[model samples]
Target: MSDDLGFGKLLDDDGLVARLLGKTCKGRNRPLLYGPDLPVVFLTGGPGMGKGRLLRCVRDEFGRHVPAAHLDCAAPVHAERAAQHPSTRSEVTEALRELAVQFGAWSGDGGAIGVPRLYAGLVAVAAGDPLAGQAAGLDEVRRHDDLLPKGSFWGGVLHRAFRSYLAALAALFAAQPLATPLITAILDELFERVSSEGKATLEDCYGAYSGAAGHPRLGLHALSVDFQQGGEGRANAESFLFRALREDVEAAYTSVRGRMARAGRPAVLLDHADNALGRRLLRPVLLDRESGHHDRVVVIATARRADGGRFLYRSTDADAGVVTSWSPGDGGLPVWQRRQGGVPGLVAPARGALLVGMPTLTTEQQNNEVARLQGHGGHSGAAGHGARSGTSGAAGHGQGHPGPAGHQPGEHASRLRVESGIHRLSGGRPRFVTRLGEGAASLRAPDPAAFTDWDLLDAPVRSRAEPEGRPVPVADLLLDDLVTRQLPEELPPEQHDHWLDLLSHLSVAHTGACAQHLMQARQEGRDERLSAYRITELLADSGWPQCPRHFIGDRGLRHLLMRRLYRLRPDGAAWQEDHELLRAHFAARADTGDSGADEPCGTAGAHAAHHHLAAGGVEAAVDHLTGAFPLRDPSRSMARWCEELLAVAGAPCAAPLSGAPDDRHARALGEAPPAGGDWLRRRVDRLLHAVWLYEDRTRPVDQALTGTWRPLLDRLGEEPVPGTEVLTRTAGEWAQLAQERQPLKPCACTRHLG
Candidate 1:
């Protein structure tokens, strides 16, 4: 499955992993800060779009060559820690501890200097003592010790100055329960020492620590206090500590890189950048240029696109020289450049950052995925038998069957159909495809061709490892979970129902609902007092799209919500009512000059027609059909509209136009009332008018007419109704017109007519 899905190609196509390794390769003769000098690459996409899977694949393929450490931000502990506004010291401690363990494995050191040891080593360095407590021989301590010349005059001065700062940090760490105010105070003192009066004490320390290689120097006082007073103070403190730990890790990497030449630079894969902790961690690494860690390690992270610009750019730091630099050019022309330099042509800080977006599988990939699943030994027998039966119902209980060795005759066609259905439903999402494949594998009778549109829409989840009872569709379970997740726990019960109703109404809409449409929907309900702005705000907070054209966040959730709408009212009354309200709302929009070139005529008219027909308003449907029907010329969009209209026509009426009960209509011998007859005649006449317009007005007849109009004409002929003669006459006239327009060529519609 992995090979067929092009997982390997996905990694190699851009050579991202290769480039990252090359950057950190120890033997390279380039300058200290050459070629991107970025340690972080962000993989951004929607949820379940395979970011995690891709990360795992990278680990599997490159783990032996380049040690990779993966940290899942989705874990409960991590998630809870992220939820904290100002992530606590304990939270940061826990995360650092986890990272240290992962890094140890990557370095083949096996937790030799774990988080506790590293923390103690940092304290020792700050205290200017190599052998303080348990810090002796620790790599971090050794790195710090290497920065000073033993017994030198300047080194002695710097050593005495760091003593006070180190003591404060040590005290902060030793505080048993680590109070926030105390930590803040210690950090404030450290910042003041490094950036202000203390700067004179360690004037030469920065140059000595960073080495005189022109790499940006790190300063302890560089920490910003702008975030110290807000609810975000805790998070800021954690960030400071996270940066410190990272520096320690980078220092250790510098020492290890020289010896582990074959392993290349270690890559840290931080998944779930959408989470709070991940976002906080990203700032120092991706946004802070002066940190100098980018020149030492590789950081690969994942985030959702919806997180906006937070991770897209680095903040302008005055100390980092983020202003314009002017120099004399070849012709004595002034050359202006960004202070924080990047790749040759790019000026933005993101040039040093690689952003890879997750993409859906192509058609060929989807086909390969289906074939791989069907060929599996466990599913072969059931799928083969189900294909031969040509009935989906028989395949519903697919479980155990005799295995088949190879594909039988005609199996390819069935597989193709099944692949198409799955592609349409799953949109080639890897996670959804996996779930569908598992469901198919477990089916008692799994016929690819037998799968219908409705079945595809009702996506199944993988059953538990062991059978508990009758299997239920996974979509049903997910729908309930999605609803609960979207509603606020504190919302009143009645308001909750109102929100659900609003969602159901929006589900019926073809495109995303704009604020105005939502406002009208709210007005249609009894809750006119409900503020549209407030409702939208709450929905957005619950993870729904907050853009102008708002939509439910996930496609799978959208499908499940649609199914819920269908089953909301057993008698179909609620379905009709919602559609009626939506139809009226759109019609009013059209009246208010909302219809324009941007609003394609087909989309606007076709959606209204669907709602009108579902509400048993046939006359209104016919009116909408006239607006959408491609009377002048049928393009592909118009053909699709025709298909949709045909589907609506074939569906059973939700309620009689006269509003009579079902039993009343049955007692009336199922005959059409006068109004019903008039409605049907108008619908038929509009369809015929569309045909007439195509025959008389359109030139170089569209080939799509053969597929679009012919099916409707044939369906009409099959109906034993009073308009059979008129349908026959229309078909004859269309054929004659086709012959007159292009006598030499044979028309598909003309052939179908005969």
Candidate 2:
């Protein structure tokens, strides 16, 4: 397996084939074999977590032994056609045709290949036999025509009906690329006529025809064409056509199963099943256990983890039979059987289903991957020796010194440091790891001596760090490819800016962005007429939200996009403006009786206050905090905010503010309270109020304030305000009270009391 990048370990340990074939292993570590019941394996993960790569590996490994077809549902052509057609039946039909074309079942005879022909090809490969040298399987039926009960008068009527239908099929095939709805109607009529006049049913004809020597190929190709042609007929035809198509597929599957069992089970791999058509197909396969078609062919599919429950509306009888299901694991990579239920206690796996959660790389695996990328040949002894020697000279020279763990200097330490950096930056996601590695390789110094600069390996393409240290341009490039470029061209141009604004606001939030919060923000925006519901709908339609809550769902994308938004305005003006908008929106909501307004020590008020302070509105910020503060109660939240404010504004102490009348204080004292009080008296009053509330002997110092409050006390010491001596005495008393209440606990502030 080369073990070059640990791809072998990932596929083998994940149980991809066993679950698809419905095999249950005795233990977690055991290898699984393909079993009798064909399962629909849904392989789901976040974007760029290697779902596609795993599918490719599966195709390459299993294609040799069985007939396996892989279809990428995310292809632009499929999406475009689905958009144009806007019918689930058409989408499924197109998907099937694409699969057939990929598996070489479609002969390009200017006719749509029927389910029977497609099955025959699949079965041929399954049984280790090549198909006979004939393009059309229809010729095999000639030898069995006499087998029909033509002697009886009823049989005679059926025979003629069958012949007429075959002739119609031939004519449709001859025309090539005709409307599927038209052909479906013709087939429907033919079946109805035979059932009424000949006392034969659609199933009866299918059985007799398929049992024939050649199982005469019916040209079902016409059923997938654009029959409605923008007419009212198309609207009504979809439901009927879809039902007929499913029936035909099921019947064909039943016919092919015996052969497939004898030859060995064949499988179909559907990639990017999170797409519209893929989701449509997933519904029946996951929900309808009674459908014989699902039990006939082994189906393997991939989708975004967030969409794992897209098809499952409610738990059903078929909820437990899924052989293997995959979703994003806790560490954000695809693992097996991690997610139990969406709503905790209410849901369970579908009947006959085995759920698998995808896994992220472990630290060791990540390190190995980095080593492989750097061409270290799997961290062997020789490589270690070379690395240490290479970095040794540079270590002493200070170009790349080893920190703390004093190992041999240069290449080894540099490699280790780079590997650690890559793991941290990429979050052990395989796609991100690969991208970062490739980017680093391209940017690596040509000379070996300069290889230890780990910063160069940070992102794939380095952008001039605007304002330095922020990876804005690199983030922009990645987001441009992953999100901006992928956004449907149909989206309004103005919506792009709105999405960016939403992203920017969420980027700085303490909790992840919630759709509900964003809607609230939009409702409080300048345009009161804008519909929050419509904006959310547009975002969903744009394929940006990874889950219902998070827009741009992939964690890597979320991080990079947030970085890009954080640095959108280099001068910080735009950031401050966005934050103010957010603060005002939440404040308006709070004032209007929003549910979260009365939340106990809630983060919303804190966030709003922070933004207000950042925008240089200290009084407004203080008002928000004070208003939200629990009455007659000490609050750690208030204290945290106070500490943050003090750090940013610097110790609010100066000779003029303390009444000593320095030039700056004289100027400040001359101005109006709204303008000058913020920098002088009011600032000191707010800081003192916060300290006084926190130091109220009734309130015990929580862990958050244990070592934290000392910083505020120290900063207060630096200020030569009028009540400095009283504040110092107050701080000493608060420290004494804390030590008496919790003797063993060491408080940093208590040391100042001594």
Listed in order, each prediction's TM-score against the native is 0.59, 0.54
* Tens-digit per-residue lDDT, 314-367, candidate 1: 456222323222111112212222245454323344434545556666555555
Instruction: Give each model's whole-structure lDDT.
Output: 0.45, 0.43
lDDT of 2 by residue, 496-526 (tens): 6565556554543332333345546544755
Best by lDDT: 1
TM-score of 1: 0.59
